[model samples]
Target: MITLLIIAAALVGIIFGVAAILPNDGYGHRPVPRSHVDSYPTHNPFL
Candidate 1:
């Protein structure tokens, strides 16, 4: 049981370590491109 627990912990740690080392591109907060800007209306009546 202890060995299984250790293996699980190690796997979790490795996953987090790898994720932490990778580069991020704004994490989904990137700005919209100029080309798609005109698709949405300047003013929305629903809002």
Candidate 2:
């Protein structure tokens, strides 16, 4: 019984972790993609 409880707790924790991290892919609110910002020109293109 104790083993079963431990397994259940682990499963719940994993679920919560996955849920928290799964929304980062443009979940309809985050501004510009980070990839683009990181690759942007070093010097201001306008200058």
On lDDT, the candidate that comes out on top is 2
Query: Candidate 2 has what TM-score?
Result: 0.48
Q: Please identify model 2 stretches exceeding 4 Å from their true place.
A: 24-47
Residue-level lDDT tens digits of model 1 in 1-47:
99999888777666544533455222443334443223434422221
TM value for model 1:
0.49
**Model 2, range 1-47, lDDT digits (tens) per residue?**
99999888777666544533555423444334443223333322221
Instruction: Return the lDDT, model 2, position 13.
Output: 62
- lDDT measured at residue 8 in model 1 versus the true structure, 0 to 100: 80
Clashing pairs in 1: none
